[model samples]
Target chain A: MDEAAVSSLAARLADAGITRLGRSLAVRHVDAGSCGGCEISLAGAVALRAGLTRYGITLVDDPREADVLLITGVVTTTMADAVTRTLGAMAPPRFVVAVGDCAVDGGVFKGAPTVLGGAERIVPVDLLIAGCPPSPGRIIAGLVALLEANAAPVAAARRSSRIEPHA
Target chain B: MNPALDVAIASAAPPGTAVMLDAATWRSLAAGDARLGFVGLFVSGGRVHALFTDGSAPLLLATELIANAYPSIATGFPQAAWFERLAFDQTGATAEGATDRRPAIAQGAAGTDAAWPRFIETAGEGFYQIGAGPVAGRIASPVHRRFSMGRFSMGRFSMGCFSTDDTRILRLEHRLGYAHRGIAGLMRGKSPRVAARFAARIAGDATVAHAVAFARAAEAASGAVAPPRAVALRAIMVAVERMTADLAALAAAVAAAGDARFATLLGQAREQSAVALGEAFGHRLMMDIVVPGGLALDLRGDAVASLLAALDRASLVVRAFAWGRVRRDLGPAAGIAQARARSIRALAASVRADLAVVPEGIIAAALPAGTGTALGAAESARGMVYHWIDLLDGQIRDCVAIDPSARLLPALEAGVVGLDPQAAAVLIACYGLSVGAIDG
Candidate 1:
C-alpha cells in the first residue's frame, strides 16, 4: 500500500536474484477446466495488480521458451492433449508448477471419468501450490519459493506441495 | 446523440461480407427498454458490437425463453447456438429448433441424459459420432478417455491427455466426453474457498478472469476495493496469460499448417512466458492471484523492474517474428487473406445470438428475449465462458458457468459447415478454445 513497502519488496526480490535478468525460466500454463475463477485471479496478478513483467520475468508464448509450466483448473479428458502437446513443445530443464489444487490434484473434477486431476498425470510437476487458486500474493510467494528452490544448490530440495491425496 | 453513434448506426455494415442487420436497425430491433429481454446494445465502429444488461431474477423462465428462441437467433446471429446450449446446460433451457442438445455438465451418471455437442445431421447412426472414452474409471481408463462413435476415435495418452491413432488423420466433427464432472453440484454447498477451485475449472486461462469477476461481484456486494498494488499485479498476470495463450494458438495454427519451424518458435515463446510466470508469481500460471476485494499478493519495486526488463527482452522476441507472414489473416481478415487484427473489443463483442452459448470475457450479460438473470463471459485461455450466478440473500443459490471451448466445439462442427476441415480447425483455434476450458 505504501511506496516504502514496495521499494523494500523490490530490494528483497533483487537480493534473491528473482528478477528477469538473472532468471532464465520458462512457463507453460495449463487450464484443467476451471470456472475462470482462478484465471480471473491470475488475471489480477498480471493485468490489474502485480505486473510480472516488472520483475524481468515474463510468460513465454511458446512452450520452448518455458522453463516452468504453470497449470490451473481440473484436467479434463478433452484438454489432455492440449496440455501434453504444450509440454511436448517445451525443451528440457522444464518445471511444471500446478497452481491450484485442481492441477496439483484434480479438485472437483477428480474421480469423475471425464475429470483428470493434477497436471502430473500428463507431465512431471516440479512444484505444487495450495488453494483453489492461491492469492496473487500467495501465487507469487509460491513462484518465488520455486525460484528460490530452483536457484538453490543442486542438492537443495524444492518446495513440495502440502495438498493431501485425493479423497 | 454522438455523431459516432449515428455514423455507426448508418454504416452498421460489415466490410466485405453483407452484415445480417444494420447497427441502428439492430439496436432498435433488439431494444429491450426495460432491460427485460436483453440490455446493452453495444456496437463498435460500424460493426455491430456486443450487448449487455443487468438481468432480473426468476431466471428459469427467462432462460426458457432464450432456450426456445436460440435457433431463431441462430438464423440471425449464428453465434447464438453456443449460448442456447449453455442456457440449456445451466438452466435446462433449450432453443426450440436447436439441433445440438449435448449437455455440457450433468449430475447423474455420465451420458444418462448427457446433451450432445450440437445436433449434427445424421439419419439413424450413419453420422460420425465420437464418444470421448472415459479418462478414468473402474471399467475403463477414465483419465485417458477417447471419443469413437464409429470409425472415428479420440484418445488420451497420459494425465488427462488426448491422443489419436497415428494412422487416423484428423477429421472435424462434434465430439463428446463419456464422462462429465458435476462441478456445479459439488459447488452447491461448499464455502467460497471450497468452491473457489471450481471457478478455475471453468476455463484454465480465464481462471483469473472468472475469479476477478467473481471477486468483483463479491467486492461490489461488500463495497470493498482491491489494493492498487494488487490490481496492478492482476493486470500483468492476465496479460501474461493472454500472451501465453495467444502464442499457443499461433503455434497450434503453425503446426496445423505444417510449419514446424514457426510452430517451434511459437511454442518456445509460450514456454518463455510460462517460465517468466513461474519465476515472478510463485505459481507459473498465477492462478488464484485475486481475492474478493483485493489481490492475493503485491508485485511492485524489483518485480516491476524485473518485469520491465523482461518486457525489454520480449520486445526483441516479439519483433523477431514476421507477424505479417505467420498470421493467416482470417476471421474477417481470413476472408480477405489480409492481416487485419480484430481488436479485443470486437472479439469480445463477437457474441452471436444463434450461438449455443456466449463466448468468453463476458463478465455479465443480459438475457435474450428480455428474460431473467443471465450472465456470460469468456475466460482468459480456454475460450469463451458463460456464467449466470444466482444469489439469494447474497448467497450463491445457483451459478452456471460455460467455457468457450464447449461453446466452440459445437461451432467448430458448424465451422466445417462449408469449409475445409483442416483450415477450419486452425481458424477455430484463433477464437481461443482449449479442451480444458470446456471440460472445466
Candidate 2:
C-alpha cells in the first residue's frame, strides 16, 4: 500500500547480486503463512517466462541443499519457528527472497494478531517483491534484478561473521 | 424439513431468520435425521447455529447455550467436532460432551509454541513419532501432522506435536488455521460491494466460487435477483475456474503416480487456462469478479473466445490422455482412491461438457436496497460451498462461509494414516483443502 516504502525496499534489494557464484542456484521454497495465491504466481513465473530450469534455478526438497530460500507469505506466530529453522538450515552464501505483499509487510492483514508482520521480522531478507500476489513476469524480473545486484562480498563477510541464524 | 423440525422451526423462528430449537429437539433431529447433512456450525449472538441441507432444501437450526456451554451433538454428526472447538476459540463456548477440546484458531503469544496443542499418545510397543510441517516442501499451505509409527506401519497420527510416548493408535490431530486472515470478522459493517473483495480472497484458487457465493448471499439478503445474463456469465466463470483447478489437482495426482509426462501435459493445460483467465478477466485468479447484485466486468467477445479456445485445447488433451481408462487404477499410494479418481475424471468430463455451453453476453443488474437474512450455495471444484449473510440497514451484520474443505480435511487426515510421508502429501493435495477457506 505504501508505494514509497516498497520502492525503497526494491532499491535496497537491487544492491545484492551473485556475480561471482556459479550460474546454477538451488532454491528451497518455504510457505511461512501464505494463502496459496503467491504460490500460483511463483509457479507461473517459473514456468511461463523465466523457465526456472533454463535460468539455472533448481528447486530442491531439502533446505540443506539450497543456496537460496524463496519464502512466501507473512510470518505467522505459528510458522515463525519453521522460518527460523529453515533459514538456519541453509549453508553459507545463502540468501532470503521474500515474495508477495504479505511477506513484504503483512499485506492487508498487517494488524492481525496472529501475524508476526513480514519476513523481515523473522529473518534478514535480501529481496522483497511487492504485490497482493505478484505477476509471474514481475517475480521473474525481481529475481533477475536480485541476481544482477551482486552482493557477493557482503554474503562472504556475513558467512564468516555468522553467530546465531536469526541475527 | 422434517415434520418435527418444520413445526419447531415455524414456531420458534422470527420472520426470515433461522429457527431456534430447544436443546432436546436439536439433539434429536441431529441424531435422528438420517438425510440431514451438516453444512456449517458456528457461534453467533450467544447461540450455536447449525446449518444443514436436507436433500435439496437448506435449513438453519440454532440452540441457545447457558454459561457458554451446550450439549455436544458431535456424537450425532461427527463433523461437528471441529466446529465445536472453533466455537470455543471464538466465543468461549464449548460442547459439553465433545471429544476434542483443543484451540482451533486462537494464536498464542509471540515467540512461544503455545498455539500448538499436544497429541494424545496411544499405548503400544516400539512406536516412534514423526512430525511434518507447519512449513514443508512444495505444498503452498502450511499443515502440521504428527505421526506415530511402528517399523512397518503407522501407529497413530496427530497434527501438532507434543511430548508423548504411548504405544497404541490414538486420534490423529491436524493443526490448521495458520492462514486465517479474519475475513468474516473483517466483513462485518462493510457494504456488500466492499465485503465481496474479502470473500473473493478467502481462497485464491476458488475465488470465483467464493465471490459468486458471497454475491448470492448478499442478493438473497437484499431480496434482489441478478439478471439472467449476469447469472450466465457467473456460471461461465465458475466453470472455467473449476476446469483449471481440476487440471491442477489432476496434475498433482499424476505426478504422484510417477507419470511425469502426463503431469507435464496437465500442468501446461492449467497454465494455459490461467493465462486465458488473465486475458478475459483483469486478474488471473479472477478475484472480485462478482459483486452484490451482479457481475463486475462485462466480458469482451474476444475474451470469451480465447477462454473457450483454451478450454477446448484442455478438453482435447483430456480425451487424448484417455482419463477414464486410468480412473480405476489410482490408489492411496497415488493419493487418490479409485472412487476419488473416478470423480475427478467426471469433473474433467464436465469441463468438456461445459465447452459447448457459453454465456451469450456479459451483463449485470444494479444492486437493490433491503435488509434480511439468507443463505446461498455454489458448487465449487471440491464440493458445495455455502455462504450465509445477515444484513441490517444495508450493512453486513454477520456472515459465514462453509468451505467444502472443512468437511473433507478431517476425513483426509483419517484416511492418510499408516502411509509414508510422500503418499500422505499426495493425498493431502488431492483433497485440495484451502486452510484460508476453512478459517474464514
Candidate 3:
C-alpha cells in the first residue's frame, strides 16, 4: 500500500474504538530465529507513521503483561523453548500472531536441521501474516482483522446482556 | 609460484589464489604483523584456510591438518579466538593450544543438552553477576550477555553495608549462536544462483550487501562479469540499503535519548524508502532480488522516478534534523546518531548519482560451469562483509560469509567495560550488532 492508504488505515484504526472496548492491546515480540527482516517491518508498524500506538496498541517488554504474542522467524532448536515459555507466560484469551513466512512455515529456512518449521510446530498461531517479511501496512491490516474478529463477539455479548436486563 | 609462496600476494591478483604454507610458516606470518587483520578461518576439503588482509590485499594461508589439529592463531591473534572456536564446532579441526576451547556455534543444537554456555568466573568480594537474554526484551535477535559488576556502597546501614547506586560493569561477555541456521551447511552442493537466497537471508538488514558479495564471489569464481547495468543497479540497492540502516541507527539513538519526535520523523523517512523499494523491486526489504549472475529481475516501469522521489523526501527529513545542531544540543550522546544521519545524506546523494548513470543492457550474465575458489568483499553499512566460496563443477563446495559484526561484537564487549548498565545498552545500540549475521 502507498503512504496515503496507510494514513487512512491509521485513521480508521484510531476510530475503531479499541480502547473504548476497555483494554488497550499489549503486544510482546519474540524473535525465535529471524534474519531480522520481520522485526524491521514490525517496528515500522508501531512507529509514529503507522501509528498503531495511537489506536491503543502498545508493545510491552514483558510477556506476562502482554495480551498478544507476536512471533517472527523460523523456530530454531535453541529458541523453541524460549518461544514456548513466552507464550505460556501470557494470560488466558491471549492471541499468537505469526508475522512472516518463516514463522508461518519456516519460509526459506525450511528443511534446515536447526529449524523446527513455523510457530505452529510449537504453539498455536491465531493469525498468519505471510511475506518474506510482511510490510508494516500488511501487519497493521492483520492486527485490525484480528481485533475486529474478536471485538464483534464481545460487543454482541454486551449489547444482548443490556437488552435482556431492560426487557 | 614457489617464490611467490614465501611472500604475500598483491591485492590485484586473481581472487582465489591461496599461498600454501607449512604450519611453522603460517604461525610465524600470523605472529609477524599486528597490522594484519584476521578476516576469517574456515575448513574446506580437509584443509584449514585462514584469511588475513593487510589493508589493501587479502592473504589466504592454507595448511594441512595433522591429526585434525593446526597451529592456533588465537594465541597470537586474539580476534581469531571466536573464529577458531567456530571452526572447531563446525568441523572437528582443533586450534591446538588455544586458550579458550569452548564450543562457539555447536552449543545449542537440537538433541544436545540445551544448557547455557559456560561463562568466565570473576572471583572477588562485592562483585555480582547479571545475565541478559538469549531472548532480548526488545525486537532483537537472540544473544545472551553475562555482565560481571562491582558495587560501591555510599554508606553502611545498621543491618549491613548496603550498596548504593554506584554499580559499575566490570566485564561483559556475549554468547551468540542462537540464530545459527547452518547457512553454510545449507548452501553446500547448491549452485551459486540457488545459494544466493541463503546468502541474502544471512542478515536481513544487510540483504543487499550479502547478496552483492555472494554474487561477486560467484561471478569471480565463474569468470563472468555482471553487465554494467546490473552493477549499477546493485550499487543503487546497496546505497538505498545503507540509507535505511543509517536511518534505523539514527532513530534508535534518538529514541534512546528521549528525542521521540526526531525518531518518528526518521522512521517516516525510512517507511517511504521501504515503500519505494517495494514498488521498484518486488520485496519491501528487497530480499532475494539479487542473484549470482545479476539481478533476478530488472526495475519495474517508472521505478527510477519513484526511487528518486523517495530519496529526495528522505534527504529533506535528514537535512531538517541537522546533524551539527543535534550533536551540539545532545552532546556526545548524539554523536553516533549524527554520524549516521550524515551517512544517510551521503548515501542519498550517491544513490541519485548512480541512478543517473545506470547503463542500459542485459541485467544478468550466465555463469558457466567452473571449478574455482574466491573471496568477495562488500562494504556494508556496518563495515566490510566478506564471503569466501569454493565451487566445484558449478556447485558450491564450501562457503563462508563473514559479517563485520564478528569483530564489532568483541569490540563492544570490551568497550562496555566500566560503563553503567544504561550507558552500556546505549553503546550496544550504537555498535549496531547483528546477532543473525554473527551467529551465521
Candidate 4:
C-alpha cells in the first residue's frame, strides 16, 4: 500500500527469469463485448498442444481460480457488473490483460451509447493487447510480456488499497 | 397494391418491391402464411414493415403495418420472434400480444435496467440455477447462459434470460445483447457506400455475405444490377467465405472432441482461406470490398492467378480431410454434429459449382439514381442473409440487414438441451452463432 511496496512491485515485475507466483499461471478470459474475431485468434494460440499450455498457462472457466484475467471487447454497460465481479473474484496476485482494440479503448465501437468504452473503465488493466483482433502470435507475445512483467507482484502489493473486500 | 392479398406483384426495380397493407391484414397474412420465411421486421417511414418470402417465390414480400401497434406474428409463425424483438428494439414499435416482449439488443440504463435476466424462483424441489457468461471462454461475442440443474443433469435452458416454469428437464437460456454496438443506428443517414461498411462489420466472420447483401440491396433500391463478372466474383467470395467458416466450425468441433491434429489442420485451412482472400482482396475479413452497384476492388493481373492457385490448394486440402470421417467421429454425441457435416458437404458442392463459372468481364456497372424499396439476399455460411433497403432521392431512408442467427438460435437451444454437457458444448462450438450477428 506504500511507495516502497509499489517500487518493489515494479522491480519484481521488471526482473526476468523469475516466476512471480511460484506456480503455473492460470488465465480466465472474459469477453465484455466483442465481434468474436479476437476469440478466433485466441483459440488458435491456446488450442491443444499450442503455445499457451506449452508455457504452463491454463485457460480456466472460473475467475476465482485464475491468476490472470484476459478481458476482450468493449466493456458494455450490461457487462460492466460481470466484469467487476470477475475482476473482484480473482485471488490476490492477479492480473488483468485487456485484449483487442475494443478492450483497450473500445476500438471502432468506442462512442456507442451502449458501450462504456474499454475494460479499463471498469477495472485496472495490467497489459493491453492491441489489434482490431490481435493475431494469435501477437496475443501470445502480449501474454508472455505480462507474465514476465510479474503481474502477481503488483497484484499482491495492491491488494490492501486496490480492492476492498465485499462486506 | 391490394391490401387484402398475401402476395404482392413485385416492381421491376433491382430491389424487390413493397406491398402496402392495413395493420390488420398484414398481421393476419404474416401469421397465417405457413410457407413464408420471416426475413426481418423493421420500422421505416412511420410504418412497420415485415419482410417475408416463400423460398419458391422470386420476390421478397414487404408487408407494411398501417399502424404502429400490430399483433405479434411470432405467436403463430414462431420464426418472427426475434425479428419482432428487433423491431421493437430498433423503432420502439410494439408487438401487441407477444409472448416474450423483452428488449432484444438494447442494454444498460438507456434500455433495460437489469443487465442480467431476472431469474424467477420456480417453486420446485432440488433444482438450482447455474449462470454462464456475458464473457464466455475464448469466443469474442458476449452471451449469458443460465441452466436450471437437478444435481448432475441439466434442466431447461434460456438464452438472453426469460423465465420458464419447467424445472425438471434440461432447458437452455441464452442472454445475448452484451455485444450490442448499435450497428443499426451507425448506418443511419450514411450513404449506401458508407453504410455498406457497417453491414460488413455486423459479423466479421460473415463480412463478404453481409457486404454482398447490402450491395445487392443498394443496387436493387437504385435500379442497378451488378455486372455478370461482378456477380461471378461475388459468388467466388461467397464460396471461399463459406469454406473458411465451415473449416472453422469443423475445427472447433474437432477440438472439442479432443482431436488435436485434425483440429489444427482445419484451423490451418480456415486461416488459409482468409489469407487467400486477403491476398486477392485488400482486407483479410474482406470488409468494405463490396460497394453499392459494384465491388470496391477488381480482381486482376497476378491477384487473380495467385488467388486461384490458393483456392485450388485449399480445395485439395479440404477434400483430403475426409469430411465423412469427421462426421463419423462426431457420431450422435453432438446434436448439430450431423448438421455441421451436412453443411460442409453442401458448402463444398456449392463451391465446386461456383468454380465452374469463369470470371472475366466488366467488374462493376454504373448505378442509376432512383427511389424505391428493394430486397436483396446472399447465402452466407450459416443461411440466407437478406437485406432490405428503402431509398429516397439516392439516399438510404431505411435499411435492414438480416443475419441468420435469429432464426437459428431457437434451433440451437433445442439441439443443446438433453445432450450431455460435453456434447452440448461441442454442438455450441459447431453452431458458432455470434450474438452480435443476431442482436446487432
Candidate 5:
C-alpha cells in the first residue's frame, strides 16, 4: 500500500474512537537495552515518507505526555527500573506496546544474566509485535491494531456511562 | 617481530596468532613502540591479551597476569584506557598503575550505586556541571554525559533555548555501558553459528559487518575457506551496509543543522535502500546472512538488479542535494555532514562495482572440526571491528568482539572539549557511537 493509503486508513481507525484520548496518539519510545535494529525500523515507520504523523500518531520524548509506551529490546537489569519508572510516570489509561522479539520474550537474549526477560517482566505490555526486529510496515500495522483493540474499552465505558443516569 | 621486544611464538599460523610474552616484556614493548597502535585488550584463561596492529598486520601479544593484575599499557596508549577498564569489569584482572581505574561496564549493572561513576569535579567560580541523558531526545541509544562548564559567554544558543550567559564546556565525560547485554557470556559454549547471532546483534546498525567479521574469525579458527561467490557476496553486503549507515549519519547531521528538507530527502533515500535490502537479503539490516563458513543463504535471483537500481536512486538523491544550500556556520556538524555525503557517494559506487562482478560457486563451505585461535577484522561503517575467537572442538571457547565504538568513545571524549553542548550533541550523532557494541 502507498503512504497516503496507510495514513488514511489509520486516520479512519483513529476517528472511530480508537483511543481514549481522542484522535491523536502520543507515543514514547523506550530503548531498554536493544540491538538498535528496532529503533532504525521505528525511525523508518515515522519518517516523512511513511507519513505516520498524518494519522495523528506522533513520537514524544516524555512519558507523561504519551498515550502509548512503545518499548524495544530485552529489559536489561540496569534499565528494568528505568522502564518501570517511565511506566509509573505515565498517566492512567496508557497502553504499553512491546516492539520486537526481544521485548516480547527476550528472544535470543533470554536467560542471559544481564537481562530481566522482556518488557512484561517490568511493565505490563498491552500489545506484542513479533520479529527479530519487526519491519516498519509490521510496526505500523501493530500500532493500528493497538488502536483498534483500545477502542473496545472506550466503547464499553461510553455505554456504561450513558446507562448510569437511567439506572 | 620487532627485535627490541622479547616474545616467543606459541603458535605458527596467521599474523594475528597469540605470541606468549612475559608481563615485563609486554609492558616494555607497549612503552617502547610508538608505531604500534593498540587495538583491543581482553582477559581469557588467566592471561591478559593485547592486540596491536603495526599498520599492515595485527600482532596478538599475551602475558600471564601476576596477582590478577598487569602493568598498565594505557600510559603509553591512551586508547587502551577504556579497554583496560572493561577487562577489569569483565574479569577481576586489574591494570595496575592505570590512571583511571574506574568501573566501565560493571557500574551499569543492577547492584551498582547511582554515585558509582564519579565525574571529575571542576570546582571554582563560574564552573558548573550539566548532565544529559541515559535517555536523550528522540530515538537514541542510552548513554549519560556529564559536561563540566566554565567561562560564561553571553547570548548563545543551547539545545533550542537562549541563555543569558551560556557557559563554555570545559570538559565532556561519557558514562557508557547502559546497554550491556552480556553478549560475550551469551556466546560461551555455543557453536560459531549460534554465537554468530549474538555477534550480529552486538550493534544492530553494523550487523552485516559484525557478522562478516565473526564469520571470518570462525573460518580462520576452523581452517575453512569461503567459496569465491560467498566472498564476492560478502563484499557487496559490506558496501551496502556502509552506504546505508552513511546515509543515516548524513541525515542526522543535516537534521542537527536545521536543514529539515534535505534531511527528509536523505531519510527517504535510506528507506528506499533498506526496502531493497530487505527484499534482497530477507532483512532490512541484512542480519544473520553471513555465517561462520560463508553466507547462510545465497542472494535472491534478481538481488543485483534491484540493489543496483536502488543505489542509482540513492546516488541521484545525494547528488541533487545542493551542498552550497547548507549553512556554513553549523559548527562541527556541517563538516561531518559533507564528509558523510562524500562517503555515501563512494560507497554507492563501490556497491555498484561489487554487484557487477559476483562469481558463480557454492555459497558456503563446511568448517573443519579442530581447535585453533585467530583474529578476524572487518571495516565497519564507523571503523575497524575485530573479533578474536578461540574454538575448541567447534565450540566457541573464548571470544571477544572489539567494536570500533570502544576507540570512538575516547576520541569523542577528547573531541567535545571546548564545544558548546548543542555542537557536542551533533558531534556525537555524527560520530555514530554505539553503546551496545562497546559494552558488548
Candidate 6:
C-alpha cells in the first residue's frame, strides 16, 4: 500500500501520453509468479476505462493469438521453467509489456534470499507499467499508444556515459 | 432439507466461521439442495461433517449418516462444477449425476480422461469470430484458452490444477487459459521456499489464499505453527493487498462506467500507494516472505510505522474517490447495467432452455444476488479478493474466486452481445475483468 513514488511515476507517464509501444494493441497476459496485481490492472484497462474494444484491440487466450504479451507477477523459481516454455509458445515478433514493479525490478523482492528479480530476467520486455500495481487509466493509455498510428513508445533520452575507475 | 441436519447446523455453526459438517449425512441433506451455498461437508467417518463459515469461527453441522447420495450441485453453482470434477478427479469421490465422470485431473493420470477438459465459446450462430490468447490485458500472461466458434475460431484451455469434488456447490467455469504455468507439476521434489513462490501464482488475486493455503498445508505436515508475529504479518500483509486489489478493480470499474474523471482519481489512489508496498516488501508480490515453519523476517517499528502511514494515505485517496466522485456517476450507470443484465439473463435462460442445456442432476442453482463480496487482506495487492472457498481436510477442496471481476464478466458479456460494440471495453472495465480472472 506504500505507493507514493510508484504513483508519481505512473502519473508522469500518463500525462506524457507515453502509453503506446509501436501501435496501440491488445495484450495477452502471462503469470510467472505474480500475486496477480498486474493482471488486475490489465483487465481494468479493457474492462474499465479505455475499454479494449473501444480501442479496436481485444484479448485472446493463446500466446500465438496475441500481438502483445503483458507479463505480470514475479518469475518464481518453480515457474522459471514454465516461463521459458510459454515464451517459446508465442508467435514471432511478440511484444512483452511488464506490468508491475515485480515484473520490472522484481520491485521489493530484488534481494530476497529466495527471489527472482524483475521479468526481464526471463523475457524481453516492450513496455513497463511500473507500480506495485499501476492505475487502470495509465495502463489504458499505454495500450492505446501502442495502437496509435504513431504507436511506438518514445525511447528514453540517452544519459551521459561515465566510466568508473576500478582500483 | 433434513430437519435434524438443519437444526444441527443452526445449533452448532455460528454465523461466518467455517466448519466441516458430518461428511456422510451431507449426502442426503444435500439430496435436494444440490445448490448449497454456505456449508461444505467432508466425508470421513461415515458421517458427513459440514464446514460452514460463521463470520467468527467454524461451525460443525450435525452429523449425517448415510450410504448413497446424489451429487448434482454441479449444475447449480458454477464453481461447484469444477469441484465435483476435481473431487471425482483427485479423491475418486463422485458427484453422482456429474458430467465427465472419468478422473478430472491425474497426478500421474495423464492421457486419461483425468486430463483437463477444455471447451470454447462456440455452437452459436456467429460471424467468423477469431479471438486471441488467454492472457488478455494491457499486458498479457502466458495463459491459453479453447474457443469453438462456428468453424473458424480455435482456442485452447490453460490454467492450474485443483482437487475438485462435490464437496461444495460453488463452481465457476474458467473459459480461458488451458495451459497455464504448471508450477504445481514442477514442484514435485523442490524445496519449500522455492515452491512458495509457485503457489502464489496459482491464482493471481488469490495469491495470499494460495500462499497461505500452501503454507497452512505445509504446517499441517510439519507440525509447526508460525510465530505470533509472523501470523500477524501474514494477516496484515494479506489484508492490505486485498484492499489494494479491490480499489484497483473499483477504480477500473468507475473508469469503465464512463466516469473517466473518477477513474483518474482512483489511478492516483492506487498507483500512489503501490510504491510503498514495493519499498518495504522485497518483491511487490512478496513471494517468499512466508515459508513452512515461519516468516523470513519480522516487521519491526520503522517498517510497521511506515506501512501504517502508507495505508492511511492510500485509504484517504480511495475514500475521497469513492464518496466524493464515483458514487455520483455510478447511480444512473448501475441502472443501465442492471437492465442490460436482466435482459441478458433472460436471453441466456431462453437459449439454455431451447438447447436443453440444463446440467443433469441439480437444477435451478445460480449465483445469488448480493453474492458480491470484497474480501481484503493487507498483504495482497489487488486488494480484498471476494471468493468462495470449499476446503476439505484443510485442503483447497474447490474454490470459485468471486473476486470483483466475476460479477462483471456476465454483465460485460450481456453488454457486448446486445449493445454498442464500442462500449465493449467499458463493459469489461466496469466488470473488473483482467481476462485472467473471468470465469463463467
**Candidate topping DockQ:** 3
Name the runs in model 5 displaced over 4 angstroms: A1-19, A148-167, B1-3, B6-13, B29-32, B108-115, B152-166, B325-329
A1-167: candidate 6 lDDT, tens digit per residue:
22454455445545656543433454566766565566655655554434566777776666666677766666655345555666677776566777777778876456543346678887776567777667566666666654542332333321234344692
Model 6, position A135, has a per-residue lDDT of 59
What is each candidate's DockQ, to 2 decimals?
0.11, 0.36, 0.58, 0.33, 0.56, 0.16
Candidate 1 residues A1-167, lDDT tens each?
23453345445545755423124444545554554445534544443234454443455556676777777766766566667776787776566777776777886677865666778888777566767656555566666555544454332322353455693
**Residue B308, model 3: Cα distance from true site in angstroms:** 2.1
Docking class of 6: incorrect
| Candidate 3 chain B, poorest ten consecutive residues by summed lDDT | B1-10
What is the C-alpha lDDT profile of model 1 across B1-440, one tens digit per residue?
A: 34433343345322211124333333342222333232111111222223322242211111113223322244334454455554455455445555545554433354233334443444333234333322211011112222222222344433243333222212345343322456655655444334556665545556666665555444433334555555555555555555556555555555555665655555554545544565666555666656555555444234433444444433344456565665543332143121112222122223111121312231222211111222434335543334544443445555555455554554455444434334554565455554444433
Which residue runs of candidate 4 sit more than 4 Å off their true CA positions?
Answer: A1-25, A47-51, A55-58, A148-167, B1-15, B57-67, B108-121, B150-169, B300-336, B342-370
Over B322-354, each residue of candidate 6 has an lDDT whose tens digit, in order, gives 443444555434543333323323432342233
Alpha carbon lDDT of residue B42, candidate 2?
Answer: 85
State the interface C-alpha RMSD of candidate 1: 11.1
**TM-score per model over all chains:** 0.52, 0.85, 0.90, 0.82, 0.90, 0.52
- Candidate 5 vs 6: which has more lDDT: 5
Which 10-residue window in model 4 chain B sums to the lowest lDDT?
Answer: B160-169
Report the CAPRI category for model 3. Answer: medium
**Per-residue error at A70 for model 1, in Å?**
17
- The RMSD (Cα, Å) of candidate 5 is 5.6
Q: Report the C-alpha lDDT of model 3 over B1-440, residue by residue, as the tens digit.
A: 23333454443366456767767766675454566677777777778887887787677878888899888877666778888888888888998778887778676454575644578797777788988887665675688889998864334653265455567787898877778888899999999999998999988889999999998888888888998888989988988998888887777766665677887887778888888899999888889998888888898868778788888877888889865656654444466666777888899999888788788989998999778998887777787788888999999999999888887777778877767777677667666768899888
lDDT of 6: 0.47
TM-score of 2: 0.85
| Full-model lDDT, candidate 1 | 0.47
- Residue B151 displacement (Å), model 2: 6.2
DockQ score of the complex predicted as candidate 3? 0.58
